[model samples]
Target: MPALLIDRPTCPATQLHSARRLIAEERLHTLFQPIVSLDCGVIYGHEALVRGPAGSPLEMPDALFAAGRAEGLSMELEIRCALQAMKDWSQLQRPGKLLINMSAAALSQATADGRWQRGLGICEDYGLQPTELMIELTEHERVADIDALRRGLTLLRRLGVGVALDDFGDGRSSLRLWSEIQPNLVKIDKYFTRELPAHAEKLQTFRALLQLAETFGAQLVAEGIEQPEELRVLRDLGVSYGQGWLLGHPSSSGASEAAPAALQVLASKEIAVMPELRRAGGSGITAEKLMMPAPAISDQASHEQLYRFFTEHEDQHAVAVINAAQQPVALIDRAQFISRWAKPFFMDLYGRRPCTLYANPSPLIVDADTGIEALTRVLTSADQRYLREGFIISRQGRYLGLGTGEQLVRSVTEARIEAARHANPLTFLPGNIPLSQHIGRLLSSGREFVAAYADLNQFKPFNDQYGYWRGDEMIRLVARVIGAHCDSQRDFVGHVGGDDFVMLFQSDDWEQRCEQIVGRFNELARNLFDAEALEAGGIMAEDREGNLRFHPCTTLSIGAVRVAPGRLHRAEDVASAAAAAKRQAKHGALAVYVMAA
Candidate 1:
């Protein structure tokens, strides 16, 4: 207000004049948009937006900033906007913290000769602490010196001011910048967060971004989330913060709370659906998911450094040694290295040598993309050294992380248990829930399979005469016969309660297998009956109409339904079709009946 304006422009560009006047007179408008915490559903901070006078051509942020930038007033204009936003924020006592954008050019230049104090002086004049401010790096311009920018950001962080990288995945967002600056927060671009539920590619990309954020120890702030689905996804994906119209629109009066719609989404108790685990080339359960982020060292590092690292950090059980190409070539167990180094004068003699001399060059190495199920099977055949040395997981031949045999074993057991949790207590086979899930997966994958229903003929009459003791044995015999005949890898056998079983076959020899089961079962079940009943060739049991009749020997019957891809979509539909085929088989004379559904 005291006329600290820059020199007037020579050209008659009204836009330049408008930009200067707004900065000089302190008449620039500022709106505040809330960046809410996705976890707590509470306001985390407000991003300050600077605009020109209402209804003016320069009122838009792009035009207004362009005008200032053209006249070489970028730094001066940014400081003025910061002051305006800060002054308003303090007056209104906004909740949480305040975020203001600083162009890369301004931020890097300010660190050259301590010009950053000018921005600090503005904060001091407004009676606000640096802790209440967050500097967002705008990507509108490239930094002349990134080192200077990093220094400036470090100074701000030391002074209790947080730093953020804005609109990540666009513009200046790069791995170099991310590693060098080490920002406290990263605001994701709109492209990944908008209508996230409808875009599969975006969903997977966002998941990888979340992992990257975790690796860098930075919190994620999803920008431009306008839909309810987008908010839920970000929240479920473990994003820390979010901003969009759905959360709260930009307002002249700072919004101090969450929007009603966002509150509703946060109120949901149901867990969000996760992205599919089974990606192409691997089952969803990969070694990467189970691998511990165990740190790796270069093979060129000295043995003394490795020893000291292990001594200082006791949690690491082993250290991997990678070559110049970042490929893991060896593993050093802490126990083994420490034992060897503890010998008298061992460190003095060998500590100066490369650590690779003490490492196992042939450690178990597994590709990160390999399915954990396959890894489990491989480990089952591995020598005892696998348990001692653990394993290395990599992707594209580059080291990713380290995994132990214990971790792999535990994960596979848990996955198997979780898959068939609803299993039959008697036979320990999958029950109805797992049966449906398997059928559903096969249908979803468009795989052609044979759905077979297995039932014992004259089972009820046998149970009534032989009592529950023999009856259970009869059922067990049927389960054993069916299980032994089917190919375990290509077939799924489930018990659908008492004398009823479901078998989903992917093998080409399913019909022969079914017939074998029937033939083998008929021979085994005859042993359960008494000699008198066998000699008489029948038993006197009440028929369905309540009259006594002769019942023949108990035999095995199987009803088979051939399912083609695209013919059935639902699990219930397939089950019903298979059941109808079984009923048809029951009225026939053949031991194994086949039909299509």
Candidate 2:
């Protein structure tokens, strides 16, 4: 290993050097990488990154940091870079933190006399509040005098400023530093993040570190998350904040908002955790592809006015009867309205009874957040009983829009036809072919995602004892359980034959959905098994060797693989990895095992 050398120069000499460079040329520039809130999906702050100017060979951060050390002005350079970063990115001055990288040696030097006072003055000149600024300490650098370091940190804290341990876990002193420093934030280094999906042990270590950070009352921010899959995995591991190229690349302009191109990149990077319907390049039809936006009606008139409007907008098959506030009150089908108009004599004797074709508000509804898969479920429900014309969607008892049975049927039919080409006959679901296609799209999209491989624990034994009929029922029950957990039309729950099922969860509510599936499946499974067999806690089955044996009963073991962005290149790799994680969960006696890190 190469020796780690940190050089120092007198503050005045370094200041002159930096000032001359600024006057002669633009030696310094800055980039802002967002540090986002995991819970709310909001930009909580930005970590200001410094780089040398375009023409300089020290254009990269590693090269610049090394050059500063070689020039024997590491601390001065660091300080100058941080100050420049603040000035360049000042537009990001929101109700959020601004992280500026600081060398431990510079801080130590500043605290030696009353250097903090001068530094604080400079901060004031830059229009930054102590509370808004965070000093990010490079973890590898040694803080020689613990008392001095503690004093400086304490004083900064007193001024209502925060400190963070940067590149945390990259060196030996991280654990010790945690006890001594007690910073407000701990940024897990990218080294650990890179191995998350493939290395189980490292993932556990990362999780433990996060938990340790939480115990110390520090927020955990995982850095170097460059892949869609990696983001999903870290999110599942309960990381509170993250920054990476996949989320958004750094920009020196201090622009806080994500641009359209950036948003497109974020959206396209599909991890298995994202809903399946969102994945691209499958050539398969889905509800998302078929569904049209709800037609908006502005004019609010009485029933007569609505009748006339429907007549004018005859091309519209179905229209929502919205009130003045734009709340959907009822659905008016073109056929029903025209039919009623044709038979006015029928309404004259019946007093508008025959013409009044109003769908009940309870069953005919959909929310904006409702996914296509969940919408499909509502459409499929026998108990809900959708009308021939359409269903009315409302929120807070206010009408929002309308969904037609014909539209839904058309969507399902197209999907069903496409699914049939690659479906397993036994389960009547899209098989490995379609599953692989979807997974490939997910991997290619480069978004944070989760791929869950759900399998029935001790299922073979149950099948052996109860025979195929009960086994089929179990499979159907599992399908229903998986289906019930799906919310978005993009979210996919597919039967992969037998007891194995697959689901892709995107968005933030995946964990909750998993819990729901587990709870509901357990409740449903208990009644499916014979009371005696269930009580015995063992079921007889034939193993791979073909000999009959009694196997211990167990719950479903779902292997959830969180795909970090840019971490994975293929869907098959993810599937295999998830299967492996499932086996790990089974061994550890866990009902659900998330692939570590």
Candidate 3:
């Protein structure tokens, strides 16, 4: 047998002295761990984690912070760590938000003495705006004054700073604090994320927290995601942002690298999943994800200057020309510029002139919000010259980056293929596979909305009398009516199969919208029958029991379920509730029933 091992605790004096020396000498350092956006597969931000002196007793973060708290130096240590982290981050000048950890005690103290302003001042000195820095409140210690903390956070917000609640679901009062503070972001604790794919309870808990965050208008970040399985599960659950060792590890240097190979593969797989999740309507991919950062030249730059830039960067296919307002005016293709300059007597004619003379007058430009499919349509319709020149991606009419026609084509093809596999053939609406995923996504997003399930009452008899073709027309007609009533940008309308359909209403006036759909559907459905059937108000057909009978014209019955985040956790639960409501609606002719909360 191995020898027995016993651990000894450090003395109070020793711990206190270590903490004091660490603060006095400023031996603390910060390591940056990248937080990635699951939706776009890019680095959303970098969270700065504090580190103690190497080979010292307080090298670990828990030991350092705990020691500081024991020795009454928590506030001092916290401020010094934040200052050092910001200073290090400033040196790298990386784009995206910088997340800094702060304790409740430290925050309360900083607000009291106006030290928080000094922190913001340091940030400004480093050329960072308040909006770019996110102060993450760690739950190491209980807050003494909740009201004072809120006041401090409100003041910070006024300065354009973003606040985040860290390690949520680990502390007893986290839920209460979230309700009172309404932070801009919430990070779920590692306990919930670790081995999440295997634990049903953990997954359910995470789903609940996701809903809670959505209800508060706060974005959720999953922490300590070390496994690809965990990442996949989170992505499927519609978690928008996450940070984990699997994506990237902490680095002393400020360079936050791209996600690892495994994660890249997972990100690609996520794109395929997007079409299924968004089948009811939106594009899963946006221009922002496809854009590549290219050098932008001032419109006033001389041709000689532009030539030199192209010569130095052999890999550059195109460059953007921007005006004084930083709006893209034209895109200069490298080959065109080089060929023009290489012509005989070209230098003498225009070498000294501004590059704008050679710039394409009408460069292709697209907004970052443009969907990949829509962008493809624009590209395919454009002249061949524009396709070779590529297009500039912009946000709010300002130049962001450049995207090549090649990338757009590839993305569009993949999205189209994925969409075709899941689309319903009869009505061309998204099928049940996408419907279930969409419902789960909505619930995970934490927004309270309405889900309405529609079934055509007495559809079989009408189909029996009118033949399959007319039945198809009737189903298609109902789909058109539902689409007309829905806000295409906000609501999701899907065909579950046969005469059944589902709609997710996110608009504030969902009740009125559902009523409108019901009323319109009843009116439009009548047109599917002939004048004789309309006058008789019935179709002669064989009933399900094989008995001859006169069936009334088909009518629509809708069961609407109002979903509150915490109350309904799964898509299956929502479906069951909606089904129950639909049963009530079918009891009456041309009716809708919205289930109570």
Strongest candidate by lDDT? 1
- List the candidates' TM-scores in order: 0.49, 0.44, 0.44
**Positional deviation of residue 477's Cα in model 2 after best superposition, in angstroms:** 24
CA lDDT of every candidate: 0.80, 0.66, 0.79
> Tens digit of lDDT per residue, candidate 3, span 1-597?
011112224454334346666665556788998888876677888999888877777888889988878977777778778778887888778888999888777777776777777777867887878888888997634877888888888887888879999988775446878888888889988888887755657877877888887899998999898877678678777787888888788888654554675356455422212222234232569988889988789999988889999988888899999999999998899999999999998888888899999788788888998876677677557365656877899999899999887877777777766664467666777776677877887776676878898988889998888899989998998899888988654577788767888888877888887788888888888988889999999788888999999888898889998988788887888888887888888985547888864
**C-alpha lDDT (0 to 100) for residue 199 of candidate 2:** 57
Model 2 earns a TM-score of 0.44
Candidate 3 — which residues are off by over 4 angstroms?
1-17, 171-173, 270-597
Candidate 3 lDDT? 0.79
- Candidate 2 lDDT for residue 261: 39
Residue range 437-469, candidate 1, lDDT tens digits: 778867865668999998888888888888998
For all predictions, the C-alpha RMSD in Å is 17.7, 19.6, 21.0
Best by TM-score: 1
Better of 1 and 3 by lDDT: 1
Candidate 2 residue-wise lDDT, 139-183, digit = tens: 445777777788878887888779998988786445788778898
- Best-first order by lDDT: 1, 3, 2
List the lowest-lDDT window of 10 residues for candidate 2. Answer: 273-282
